[model samples]
Target: MLKIGPIFNYLQDMADKDASRMEMSIPQLMEKGYTWVLHRYHLSMIRYPKLDEALSIRTWHSPYKNLYSLRAFEMTTSFGEVLAKATTSWIIINYSTKRPMRLDRHVTSQYYKEIIPFEFDFSSLSPLERIDLEDIYPVRIRDLDINNHVNNAVYVEWAAETVPTNILQSMRPSEIDVIFKEQLTYGEKAVVQTQKEKTASNVFDHVILRESDAREITRIRTSWKNMPL
Candidate 1:
């Protein structure tokens, strides 16, 4: 089965392609001293594609809300089976100041189209109340993206690392919600704290913190399903 990290990269790549079609690619934005940063993601998977399987991914953006933009994605198999659907929120920030910038009228009115691929609330996700397991991983240069911060997909992989071995082997994530709080850089250590939900045995909540200051970097919730026999 495909892992969440690779799936996330695929979705991001599709979004980049869509942006490029609109002449809003990362390099284009960078030339203007601005770049898009992901704020939140909600991904729900029906089934992961198998190796060598062909799939189609479609992505589109809705009208911007001030400095934020909402992008939606859908992945389908060749037979037209829906494999996954995702919604992401992003903010355009000035590269020098690192502060969010207002969406330009042309960018908002001309580029964005109102499209509802799937309905999902962008509300804040609940945090982990207690820690059932914890692990630490040192950030590596390879973990950083072009932005010089930890890649968004790495957070999901970090959260998954805290899962119990038995659950990892027997179950697959069906839904994942994530909120990125702060950036993590190379040489930093990430402490991943996780808790299994009491009410939902197959659900887990995770918080990634900077080991040095204990500052929260990301929050994630994952719901798992038993794999087929």
Candidate 2:
């Protein structure tokens, strides 16, 4: 029996959701001369299901080109309400050269047999207005990854915490994208500021900064839907 919390913990949830499906394993793909790297992802938790809830996930490749892979997923609870849904963009890299490559026909056929298009229009709530709040979190030793910089997951964790719980519980995240502009080394301080979009109901924009030096490290835009957007 797969327990929910441990495997579905903050960071692992994003990864395990992808690993449980798919015809070919990541390692297998690497051996076959391709590597998959996550470009961006959006996660929304609408009522985190109980521990014993029997859940099922289905993933399909919507389409792809040399630069990116468009994959979609549907997650349902045992009682059958869609718990989580997301589309991920992945890039196939040449392991030796570390450059992106065009997706192969054989690989596309293996993952997706038919193409169905779906767009939630989450962008309508993006690029929020400028209202400012200060968020400071100490960069812990554990936050440091092998690259000697703060891990990307930490940014998401901080942003999620800063978002109001009522808004988060009522709305699911329709889309989220972030760009890493700089690095935050261990023992360095980090700060975050979030603002809402004047044009949209639940759009939030955030900036992560290095508190010690006041250098911006990342920028994030998040959009939410009362129902699925």
Best by lDDT: 1
Backbone clashes for every candidate come to 0, 3
Q: By TM-score, who's the top model here? A: 1
Show model 2 residue runs off by greater than 4 Å.
1-25, 28-34, 43-47, 94-98, 105-131, 136-153, 164-191, 209-218, 223-229
* TM-score of every candidate relative to the true structure: 0.93, 0.61
Q: Residue 8 in candidate 1 has what lDDT?
A: 95
On residues 1-229, what C-alpha lDDT tens digit does candidate 2 reach at each position? 2222232233334343454355444565667666565555555555445557777666655554446566666678766898666665666666667567776632545455455656632222233356455578998887865345576677766765567778766765555666555668787888888987667678778888898888877777777776532
Q: What is the C-alpha lDDT of each candidate?
A: 0.85, 0.61
Residue 142, candidate 2: alpha-carbon lDDT: 78
